[model samples]
Target: MIVSNVSLSGCAGANSALCAAVGDGHQGGGSYRSTLSPTGNLVVAVCLGFIGTFGLLNNLLVLILFCRYKMLRSPINLLLINISISDLLVCVLGTPFSFAASTQGRWLIGEGGCMWYGFANSLFGIVSLISLAVLSYERYSTMVVPTEADASNYRRISQGILLSWLYSLAWTLPPLFGWSKYGPEGPGTTCSVDWTAKTANSISYIICLFLFCLITPFLVIVFCYGKLLCAIRQRKYRKFLAALQYVFGLTE
Candidate 1:
């Protein structure tokens, strides 16, 4: 958990008291001292290890299934593959570093690693979210306009896959350019977008990230799924009405 009292800026290594109070002398910079005791850190490490292991295995299985089974390579399934790829990337590139940091009770990697971690995770995460949103829309489209869901639909799915990555790239790149910054977050073991920074730059980026990357995709998913449910209900209702009419006509 991130404590409000912790500063975004870390003290230099030369300052003994400052360094001790903050946390460890990470090559990247200093970070907040974790409120969690050694036991808590150990628990975190264990959890991360478990999650990382399973995540790697599961996502790898998904990729293998997709590749091995040509029948599973439908347009809609492409989105699933995209999601698995992003998740697998997160497991490979992001999870192990945080796991290591948790084990050491601090971010062992330098500042560059922290920034890279924050960026990579953010990129993969946003891609997954956007891909989900696109998948929802694709389902809705397939139902509402079955004619368009033909072999030609692969182009649309391909575009969606490409756009998800592009959209994620657009959002995650801002921090590297100075719109916001990435740094050590909760417990000083994991790095992420600097949620603690109160500056206009940081706050603005956070707001945009929440609005576009999170809220927009969420709304898309809800709208698509809601329409799908309505369509299904309507189709069922029509079938029921048809059956009733047929029975009445026969009785008459």
Candidate 2:
């Protein structure tokens, strides 16, 4: 069946699926298939519907603010705006259809749509993750290193943002080239990587994607925040010592 959707760049011609049940709490998944009955599905639909609507409005407003106000156009704000863009994509593209499918207890977007929705869902999710890691590293660098604190690193940050999208494209595009594949999963209510397929190509893609995409970004986030925490502790210790020195000097 033909699926109608606004064309986007990554994996437009590819078939795919959304996050598995294990990944995003979506109905279709590995061992965690959707067990929701009609009534339960209705409840889920209500919750997801509300979240999608509210998030879309909020993220869209932030994006507009960034564009409307020059003062808001800082380097860090650029990263944040990108984050908002990714979230808004999820809201507008992934949420409604998935929720509707859940409610109906089947995939409604047709075969091609299953691929489109899944492709979109994966793309947005990776963008969000990488943006967050980049945002945290940016914050840490600005706070810890005084010299590189200004928007002088704007070029680098922009490059990083570009790289984030590129990285997402790198992983998502493989299925189209036959390195891996995407299809319906978990009770046929959702779509995602065919995790059940244990072909060598699929396994390799999964391993590489997990390492470069998931694990790498996660480590960057943790390392940046970890350093930031130590810096905070040291700053507090110095302040405490300075206060004691001032009091002792007065007594002397």
Candidate 3:
């Protein structure tokens, strides 16, 4: 009789389960397991705090250098300032929440917060890439065709900066418009773009990677470096020959 009673109780417990069994006191399914330990959490928090602080300081320094020193304000420096601002935004907005999400073991920020986080992160990342491409082109032009370089004035540079912002906006707006989905991870509950989802929008991210991050930038960098290298080699050949002459004379 005791054996039968035990079997019945076991069946009931397995079938009904407890509230703990159902959701683990969190919104998502699966057990709530923290990816970070106490020490890890503290370390991450401190690191992110440092990043945020440094980003603020770096942006302020750039601003001060540009404003106080007239010579520091150039088209290239302006591009650098914009990149610094993007980094500042990332450090200020993304890193702290990432630290918290690591500790809390779940996303307490909700759906709206998830969208905002993803948008800001994506926007900044795209902007940084575009700025790198622009800088590379500018350098290439400056080195290869000095005459053409003179045309890269503040007006043209400003237009380039505006175009980068618009490109970032194009990538980031999809989530807001319902074309793409942004939310916290299930099981782990960390906020990020849902790249692995079986959706058309998810595929758009892969396309974005190829177009913006890989192919476009690869072509830009390769083209710029190729031209720059040829120019440098041409200009330095005589100097290199003179150095070789001195070395051979000393050997003799």
Candidate 4:
């Protein structure tokens, strides 16, 4: 009887442990299922598809305009090319990840994916802004001093493009190298540099906007307009004086 009771007790204890293990597994499975549902997955897939499609179309249009038209092949158009390329990257690389995040409300791509997305997005943003600045400067130069504008060389344009790419890479590479880092908010959601984490990301974006969009472009436009006004005034004065000379000669 004693031996039989001991065996029964042991069996009961084993059963209890098994039950507890099963219970814990059930809870874990439930939590995971709730976190990643089929609906969420579908949403993510759709978002990525749409973003990719849009990017493809936009980039193709830009490429067509630049390639097919000789009239559009100028310094200003070169800057547009850079902008279109950057926008293409943003649509192809950055937006798909963003769509995943938006649909799933989490990051599905993991740490490596997050870093890649952040880097591409940041790089393209910088390129777009720099291209805008270059375009503005080119327009201003063209208007302000048309003669001097003819002096822009291939070397200068190439240097500007290189510098813009380098500037973009500088902002993007740090996060990849761990000097900074970005991660998904969750399973299907990714984010850029943690702007809310008291990092310099927000500040850098603000400074870039101020410098390229507000300060530099504004100054260029103003200077260009001033030069235009002076030119117009001089032209009018010369024409008026010529007319007066003709009138006096006819009268005499």
| Ranked by TM-score, top first | 1, 2, 3, 4
lDDT of 4 by residue, 1-252 (tens): 001123332434433322222232344321111134668667766867786788779887988988999877776677778888888888877777666555654444544565667677777887777666666666656665564323454456667778779876865666565454553333324446644334466466546545754576467656666666777798899999889989889534
Tens-digit lDDT string for candidate 2 (1-252):
112232324434333333222232232223223445788778778888999999999998998888898888888888888889999999998898878887876566555676677778888889889998999998898788665336667887899799789889888878766877766775556667777666798899889888988999999999999999999999999999889989889434
| Per-residue lDDT over 33-73 for candidate 3, one digit per residue giving the tens place of the 0 to 100 score | 34456676566667766877887788878877888998888
The collision pairs in model 1 are 28-110, 28-111
Q: Estimate each model's TM-score.
A: 0.88, 0.80, 0.75, 0.61
Lowest lDDT sum, 10 consecutive residues, model 4, at 1-10
Tens-digit lDDT string for candidate 1 (64-91): 9999998898889999999999999999
lDDT of each: 0.83, 0.75, 0.66, 0.60
- How far does residue 221 in candidate 3 sit from its true spot (Å)? 2.2
Quote the RMSD, in angstroms, for model 2: 8.5
The candidate with the higher TM-score, 1 or 2, is 1
Candidate 3 Cα deviation (angstroms), residue 138? 0.6
Comparing 1 with 2 on lDDT, the higher-scoring candidate is: 1
Instruction: Please tell me which predicted candidate would have the highest lDDT against the true structure.
Output: 1
The candidate 2 region of ten consecutive residues with least summed lDDT is 23-32
